[model samples]
Target: MFSDFIELIGAFVLVLAILQISSDRLFFSVKVYALQSFFVALSIFVIGLYSSSNDLYISAFLTLLIKVIIIPFTLFEAIKEMKIKREIETYINITNSLMIISSIIIISFILTRYIDLGGEIISKKIFPISLSIIFVGAFIMVSRKKPITQLIGFLTLENGIMLAATSVTYGMPLIVEIGIFFDVIVGATMATIIIHHINETVDDIDERTVENFEE
Candidate 1:
């Protein structure tokens, strides 16, 4: 039962990532990120329940508090304030994006097949998914033209790393987890401010325009 839940949560998070990259709507992507973060937190909580790890419990709580709730709320509010609705363009079309994402997943599975991390057997199962999430998140950062969409991609990448750490090692040191959370919160807040500034300075927050800037 425990292993089954682990696989299920990991798979669902991967599906959400696929969904996010396939969509052009910025708000929709942000909502998808929030859902993905929720699953990451849930996975930690489930693992903690089975392992009786207090650190995992606290880590799960922080994930819920920061990733699922606060960050999303802040981004959503920032978007509302900016009155931005959707991504102006994606460098890769949806059809090609799906193809690339599929290829990334297959390659991840192939790459991690024989490697062993010496943690839970389930960690081996999740390793490829975590790796794929990291790659796909990076792809998201590059393939989307909007800064906000890239920010969402960055956050997704972080969630993938967190998922791997929580599942593989069972949990990191409590203080380390807390420090990571602090860094993420600070980074997210700063990124949001930058995005807002971009929106204010330009008619559209498109990356293409950024390259054309005189400076």
Candidate 2:
């Protein structure tokens, strides 16, 4: 019953996450994004319990610490620094986004069916959701214009990738996990710098248009 609950929670979180990505409000989306990571952390911990893997449990703790806590705080700070409004302008309509997301979910399930996952019980069941989450994350990054939103999207995708890897492999080696986290830290730092440049490049559409015309 406990494992089943965890499994359901994981799937539910993924759904909320994708919806949050499609939202037109920036702060609300970020809040939902953090909520998604929290549920992911919980799911990881629950997976550790079911698998009886110490490494998974540790990884879950770190996932909670880094993803749920530290990363969100960092992102919030970035958002404040940018002083951007909470209003988001989406190029695509919400209904179309929902349809596309549904299609991605179907595609994920179909693709997951072809591969034989590790000999784990839960991994196979969760695999489709994991893949969907990744695709959704990537979709969020490219679909939005704001760089901050793009960073959030990328991190959300990272959460899915980590969930997929750890859930499938019972967690990677300690060294590998550390290296991956380090790389993520570096990536976030670099992304912030790029966002600063993007903000400076064109604060308004007319400036952007002039720059484009000049090119």
Candidate 3:
């Protein structure tokens, strides 16, 4: 019963990831990412309860704290400081993005069907979702021009990796999970600082502007 619920939450997380790809509003994308993180944490907590793993519990707490609360708070503050209210610039239109996301989802399921997950039902259910989330995150980073949006994509990619770890192994060791959390926090902080500097120097966060630096 619990496993089914957690899988349902995982499915919703994938939907949220797809929504992020389809939406152009930067703030909306960040909020969707936060909600996805919250669901992922919930899924982790459920898995810990089912597996009786204290380490998974700790990982879930850390996920809730860092991904759900701290990172989103930092992004929101950065958005406020930058006074950014414009929609994200995307290389493709929304319809095309949606079509691509759909294709990715179909391909993920097809590709996973040939791979073995050792007869773990939950792993079988989540493997495709995690892979699709990762692909969508990469697509978001490639298709969007805003630095903040790309940062969100990177975070989304990390979230997919965490989901995969939990699905495959019921979670990694506490120390390893903590290390990953630390890296994410530091990376997010550094990225936020870089975005601020880019905004100040170029007066824009568009990737094209930053890449065309003369010197």
**Candidate 2, superposed: residue stretches over 4 Å from native:** 201-215
- lDDT by residue (21-111, candidate 3, tens digit) is 8887777888999999998899899888888889988899999999989999999999888876556877788899999889999999999
User: lDDT values of the candidates?
Assistant: 0.86, 0.74, 0.85
Against the true structure, whose lDDT is highest? 1
What residue pairs are clashing in model 2? Answer: none
Candidate 1 displacement at residue 89 in angstroms: 1.7
Ranking by TM-score: 1, 3, 2
Tens-digit per-residue lDDT, 14-70, candidate 1: 999999888777688889999999999999999999999899999999999999899
lDDT of 3: 0.85
RMSD to native for every prediction?
Answer: 1.9, 2.9, 2.0
Task: Please identify model 3 stretches exceeding 4 Å from their true place.
Answer: 119-121, 204-215
lDDT of 2: 0.74
Runs in model 1 with CA error above 4 Å?
Answer: 85-88, 119-121, 203-215
Which pairs clash (backbone N, Cα, C closer than 3 Å) in model 1?
none
lDDT (tens digit, per residue) of candidate 2 on 1-215: 76467668768778876777668776777778778878877887887888787877777777777777777777777677777654564456667877898899899999889887656455465778888988988887777656677787888888788877766666788778878877887788788777667667777633322224345
* Comparison by lDDT, 1 against 3, better one: 1
